[model samples]
Target chain A: MVVTQTNHLAGTEALLERGRDLSTPLLRAVVDRLAPPMDTVAAYHFGWIDAQGRPARSDGGKAVRPALALISAEAAGAPPQAGVPGAVAVELVHNFSLLHDDLMDGDEQRRHRDTVWKVHGPAQAILVGDALFALANEVLLELGTADAGRATRRLTVATRKLIDGQAQDMSFEGRERVTVEECLEMEGNKTGALLACACSIGAVLGGADDATADALETYGYHLGLAFQAVDDLLGIWGEPAETGKQTWSDLRQRKKSLPVCAALAAGGPASEKLAAMLAADAKDGDGEHPGAHEDFSEREFATRAALIEEAGGREWTAREARRQYATALAALDGPEGRAMPESVRAQLTELADFVVERRR
Target chain B: MVVTQTNHLAGTEALLERGRDLSTPLLRAVVDRLAPPMDTVAAYHFGWIDAQGRPARSDGGKAVRPALALISAEAAGAPPQAGVPGAVAVELVHNFSLLHDDLMDGDEQRRHRDTVWKVHGPAQAILVGDALFALANEVLLELGTADAGRATRRLTVATRKLIDGQAQDMSFEGRERVTVEECLEMEGNKTGALLACACSIGAVLGGADDATADALETYGYHLGLAFQAVDDLLGIWGEPAETGKQTWSDLRQRKKSLPVCAALAAGGPASEKLAAMLAADAKDGDGEHPGAHEDFSEREFATRAALIEEAGGREWTAREARRQYATALAALDGPEGRAMPESVRAQLTELADFVVERRR
Candidate 1:
């Protein structure tokens, strides 16, 4: 199933290329202008250099946020180029999260290379994350509302949401139990808010009416939720090469992923058994490592996965994601979704499908 | 000595009030619009609330950046109000650094309370810090190109310097050895860049010519260095009640402050002995216990502090700070400085003196 979607996503390269066409020049200029001193350890975290200060090759990411922002903007009737500032802003925010997330998760690997904190140390990584965030804010401010007082209000509101979402996500890390509803709320705020912001900001920049902006925001929000659902699926069942990491890695990390929540929500024998497994994994043992679990034997792992599937975890999520994608499509219910000369709406629909269907 | 300076700084509260008067309304407005839910954590850190999320009196900071900004702008003949955006931006940058510095130093206490990380946890503290940085950028965008694009350019450059300086400061943490030149350069970037940024941004906003902006930048740079030198002195020799932390705490923490650099550079019998003490303290046991030095014999500590003073470190740094302060004052030589209204000039001069003399 993952392989089929991966192949389809490959066909979206042209859509992504169009996004790059809109985003790259502006992003490059921002990066060039804001590049820190070679001596600053945080510079190494940006993947521009090695730990010893030697130059490196492309420190590139998939540019997912940029593509999402641009597609949503175009789907809302604006030309793709109009969303360039927002595309760059969202991408910076994503990268900032990656840098700090690496530190928090203690994952020393990112992009098939040493994570920022692994190579440059946590302090430097923290600063690099900070610099990226500062740049994102600068990008917004750089595109002022022609009215200072009004613009300040909008940007500050958007920024506050971004920060709040991040706080909630981080606070969830050590908690032993969380509900499906809680996880959805977290994803909605942390990941979806920015995606919604990208679309809303794009619509505003495109001079759309308030109704159109709200619709685009809804479309982006639902799309982001669908994207996270797909991501959760990939984390558990992804192929190593496709996912760019080990399979079932989220499970290894004992993350409270969506499927796990679904199993919990089912409240059957499997749910109770899984809860015990999770609780035991989190407990500290006397004079030994407590996170190491002895209860979940290999046979039990297989049964647990089967029970999760039986409980309608992955299937339920996938169906819901498709429904949300359709809803996002419906929200564009006007000339904004259909009027683009380039069949831009079709491209956006395909991209939305790609987000929820991708294995990795 | 530190007590006297604290008393003097207390007297300058009226001047600080004047600085707040320049931009408090806009700053407060921005703070208000920071949006709720997400701002709860940030508000707590800023001392606007208790940890449980109840509102309280706002804990005041010196507002040094805003003060310097307003002073520099007015001295350059720009209306102080015209530079309020720049003032807010610099203050935001200053606060951003403080948030991260507390994390890096592992100093759980800040402003006589638990630091952001201690209260909200590191991850949330990190996000809050990033949010402030983004806010700073938003403030910069508000400045617009009121006088061509020069102010934006100055701000961008200054922000980069602040990041570089902070990066350098963090990088110096793990190293076993450092040179006086390296330490000075680090301090210049860490403490000086933002002060320089405050002045440079102010002058640019005030519509100063390139030459006058450069002069303000120079003034701020030197002033910051002198201020840091005085701070380093008090860090080791000042009273805890005056400095708001333990006396000689920097020495206990093995910080590479200016006086320590001077002592190391002296490189005589006392210097060698001090070196031996530091080396013994760092690696004398199995490398497992860096903090085990808390158990160091009293005789070892007295000998180390004595070696530091006997090397003429304290006196040398004090004189050097005075020299730098004089140099900073000299950098204010310009048409703008000469044109300042007598009242404003006196206030600005007194503010500079107050910064140089601050004990904490």
Candidate 2:
């Protein structure tokens, strides 16, 4: 799954850059008046220094959701700047879910640092999440465009899907096993829905027709599934140095990743291996086996990863993602592309590749 | 303190009944659509029945916030139907707070049974809370005839306040002491903000003039403060049998309630007694004298309650509550009580009395 890097992100990077720019200014402006203390927590969660308002370099994530939104708008033939507000809205919504997810998952770390819940405590973390959700709506409302209300409705609908997805994820926590179809359905809601919303919203904001917006939505949906598949691959198989964490991390957590599930269903050496690993991990509460799985050389997990590849899971998912990206590009064709200008559309195309191929 | 219970909810109860009639159909409609498993949890939380959805004759509290909203709408000259959405909206918001509060506070019991978190577990309890929050917004959006965008904005604003209040409350935890002014500010954000929002939103939905809406908001503001004071009093001095909980429970928890702080500040015999109790409790926590405060006895706590009255804390707070209730009623300004012809407004007034006058 190794791929060469390209430097054609000028347009996509701009979209990502624009997204990062919009969130803080608009959020600060709103909370500065309504609820000043919230800005402290919001700033912190956004990876801005401390609650003390110190300036610090922070690694904001890929901003994939916001990128999809802006790129969709440009692809739908609207000026790139036209989708700025919607981009900000989608990004805020994404961060909102991340905040709550940390609390519910009881994950102590995120983005290579203490999670919002761990540092500030759960109550504050929950409030910060709520505040971000509110601010997303507020930003949409204040966009001052004619479609602001429509954009809000879209955002709200997408958020509901995200919440539903979170519920489904939580429901699986104590379950013995989950079907592949059910897993796909959960990913559709948790991951795909937001990505779809990003593109659909961008199209709508850019004055794209209903049919075109729907096409872009379909594209984003497929892209999301593939993105998660690759993410699952990296969770266990990616380079330790490149991924900035540890190899086989997901396996250690018994996270039922796509590869693990595929291997479990293989009914051979992989299945036997997975069954034994599951039993060992099932004794999770006592914490008696801290690092026990990692003690078993990565060879077995690597073999399992190879089995996932042989099962064609990674290639199948990647093909689906590419299909979606192509469909999105196709939807941007004809008179609409003429309106957006060729240079802009080219930039957005590169952004689509960025979405599906990123290592991190 | 020994007054009869007659006419306690004279005004508020009528308004509550009318509100119930208007909102039940819509709420029931939504409840019926909830996923079976989630619905089971929600039903239990709503006091419907023990997970089986049987008809339980449980009292679902006073429904004070919704009643105030309806009464304010009527007082501002809107029809009963006009206030119905606001009624349901306020009630849902209240319940959302309760769901999360139970989890954050680690309260094991509520409404004479296990709390929602206790029954459903923390993760599911969180999901339920999220579901309620989303439903509240969804319901607001479903009001076809209402100004959906405006309604959404108003609701979001109110929700932001609620979150801010929760943040402030959490901030108070583990703090040694705080000033009365800070306490009042926190109470306003936590307890008063939503109540005020209820009245203000009802007025907006009912087509009330800005001036009238502002007055109704003021009414609710004062009313909420009064209600909290009375509740604080009940936590200390109310009978355990009547209150349906242990007497002086707040004191046992070492909660920084208004009466406790007031008595401590007076620096007299009552203050001295409170200091001794607090020191003993602190010692117990340090393992210096295990359960030292447990030996103080409930009778001594009752005597401490007498000291609160001597410090003028109870009387001062009660007077404040009465004044707020009077202000809310005065805002109506109906000729011989003719403005609010519906029973709903009357019930709301009774509910206000319940807030300030409840022995519990």
Best by DockQ: 2
Clashing pairs in 1: none
Work out the TM-score per prediction. Answer: 0.79, 0.85
Chain B alone, candidate 2, TM-score of: 0.82
User: What tier of docking accuracy does candidate 1 attain?
Assistant: acceptable
Q: Model 2: per-residue lDDT, tens digit, B191-269?
A: 7777877876776777765565566566576677777777778778776666655667666555566676666666777
User: Per-residue alpha-carbon lDDT of model 1 for A108-188, expressed as tens digits?
Assistant: 666557787777566767777766665665675556444222222344455556666655555554566778888788778
Docking class of 2: acceptable
DockQ of candidate 2 relative to the true structure: 0.41
